[model samples]
Target chain A: DTAVSQTPKYLVTQMGNDKSIKCEQNLGHDTMYWYKQDSKKFLKIMFSYNNKELIINETVPNRFSPKSPDKAHLNLHINSLELGDSAVYFCASSADRGDGYTFGSGTRLTVV
Target chain B: AQSVSQHNHHVILSEAASLELGCNYSYGGTVNLFWYVQYPGQHLQLLLKYFSGDPLVKGIKGFEAEFIKSKFSFNLRKPSVQWSDTAEYFCAVSPWANNLFFGTGTRLTVIP
Candidate 1:
């Protein structure tokens, strides 16, 4: 079984539009995260949820929001998408603070 | 002000050549270190991680990393690299948080 999975592997939308990316993990981990990979391939942590509770929130724009319905599902919603939002979004999960880090395939978003 | 640093932005090596990637973090308290590889069109895979005990940690695909507390560094090493090993390597550091702080990453190109 796939440990972590993401929906819409590729997404292309125009500016000012809104989109959502769904993520699910079956690793039975308590913590889930959303990370962004820029063109330079630099990974940046966006948000983290522990047992459906918001634990880590980085200095991201207000347009981006993360929702965790449960420990196994975490979704990202972006409003007013801009060209700068064109990047690969990755979903990851860990057993704890830094144990058993597993990542999803990623969803590529292109805002034109 | 916690950050991870990967000095080698890009590296090129031939098949069967030894490989080493430098990773450093600037954090005061105890931290966990990790090495992750992202292959072409694939998700991030954990290479190795260092939480405690045995500074030397071995991971999958014959990859290993050593954590040096004094230097606040966790460097990854491999005796011999193959062409399939070409990927982007990222070093992450977590300090009592639910998320990970990733480095800029190093692109490794192993020529066959």
Candidate 2:
């Protein structure tokens, strides 16, 4: 069974469009996170949630938002996508922040 | 300043060769460290972790890492690397319970 899974493995959208990526985990973890991997393979934290409670924002722009409906699911919503928003977004979950994480395959978002 | 630093951006090794990847972090107070690996077109996987107790920790695929608190380093190493071991390696730190910080990543190319 997949520990962590993400939907819409590939997404191509135009600028000024809105998009959302969904993530789920079956590991019974309490914490979920959204991360962006750039073209240079630099991973940056976008948001973090624990038990459906927002924990950290990571100084990301207001255009990007994350919502957690439950402890097992965390979704990312991007508004007015820009060219710079084109990157691979990864979803991950862990029992807690101090524990190692299990990551999803990632969603490749392309904005033109 | 980067929270985590992976100085070796790329490393190449032949089959059966020993491997080592450097990782350092700039953080104070108690922290949890981890090493994650991502194969081509795959999601990231936890290779090892350090959360206290023994400074040396072992994970899947015969990978191991040592945490040196004095130097703020957690270096991943494998005595013999197979071609299938080629992947991107990332070092991460959780300084607090709210978020995780990842390194820039190191691409390891293992030759047959």
On DockQ, the candidate that comes out on top is 1
Model 1 chain B, poorest ten-residue lDDT window?
B92-101
Q: How badly does each model clash, as a count of residue pairs? A: 0, 0
Per-candidate TM-score, first chain only?
A: 0.97, 0.97
Clashing pairs in 1: none
Native interface contacts retained, candidate 2: 0.83
Model 2 clashes, total count: 0
Candidate 2 chain A has its poorest 10 consecutive residues by lDDT at A93-102
Q: Native-contact recovery for every candidate? A: 0.80, 0.83
CAPRI accuracy category, model 1: medium
lDDT of 1 by residue, A72-107 (tens): 999999999999999999999988756668899999
Question: iRMS for all predictions?
Answer: 1.3, 1.5
lDDT, candidate 1, at B109? 99
